[model samples]
Target: MIVNLTTLDQDQAIEQISQLEPQLFGTSAWSPNAIRQELNAPARTYWADIDPTTTPGNPVIRGYAGIWFDGYDTQIMTIGVAPQHQHHGIGQTLLQQIIDQATADHAERILLEVRVDNTPALTLYTKNGFTRIGLRKRYYQPEGIDAYTMALPLNPHTIGFQPTHA
Candidate 1:
């Protein structure tokens, strides 16, 4: 139930991690300050999926995602759905938002690293056209889990790029 996807503001940023950190990232959860910095970064885009049908003063954040754009390339910084809300296409909606933002910013491709053992994440990325391009040994900290690097090439034409006559 994707109602309106909104940029995560300062107040919401704190709430985001507080509510979903333990459930989504476990021990590797990012600090609220870090999230604030990311939200304020010039080259980053972050969005929160809100379900408007929820009760007043208690908005439910279905999911959230962020991306970093650097001219011709984009990297997915993070994407997650609350444990209770998983497998409901909210993740896909969040992913598409980042892809759209990257495309609008003229990114030629998107890249991300996912824990190798996370089958659901791998499945979602693969379904969305991301392919395994490389691997990072022990990329995840503390637990020392390996990671798979994936990339998705974007079509310039589909991103609304128009060539100008010289």
Candidate 2:
């Protein structure tokens, strides 16, 4: 099920993020403090994918994503699905939420950067109509990985795109 990240979910989300950080972001995972600060930021909105079937105190978070919007544009700050929960449309659900949020905020466009080597993420973004607009050299620090800058225009008459299905 989809839900906004609440104060009650903070500790659990942080724990899940910590476990996936090394695998998802390699050496560039955001620190726990950094994640907390981002979640508390005024202009940021984050959401979590949870299993509604779980018991009260043991809620399972399958994935999480965040975006930063400033009225004009929205940038996807982070997105990840637990390894075991991947390939189950969770990532697409999280991404669609951000797209909808950007549309609601009247953003002109949505932007994000992904490592050039992450084929799965690249495929997901491309399928959602985000086009490669530019590149940032060595964007991922410590590892010296380059990134592709992508954007999805949010024209008023065409605020969102249809999700492609195979």
Indicate the residue-level lDDT of 163 in model 1.
Answer: 81
RMSD of 1: 4.5
TM-score list, all predictions: 0.84, 0.89
> Each candidate: what lDDT?
0.80, 0.89
Model 1 residue 64 distance off true place after TM-score fit, in angstroms:
0.4
* Candidate RMSDs in order: 4.5, 6.6
Q: Give candidate 1 regions above 4 Å deviation.
A: 1-9, 55-58, 155-166
- C-alpha lDDT of residue 22 in model 1: 66
Q: How close is candidate 2 to the true structure, as a TM-score?
A: 0.89
The TM-score that candidate 1 achieves is: 0.84
Poorest lDDT segment (10 consecutive residues) of candidate 1: 1-10
* Winner by TM-score: 2
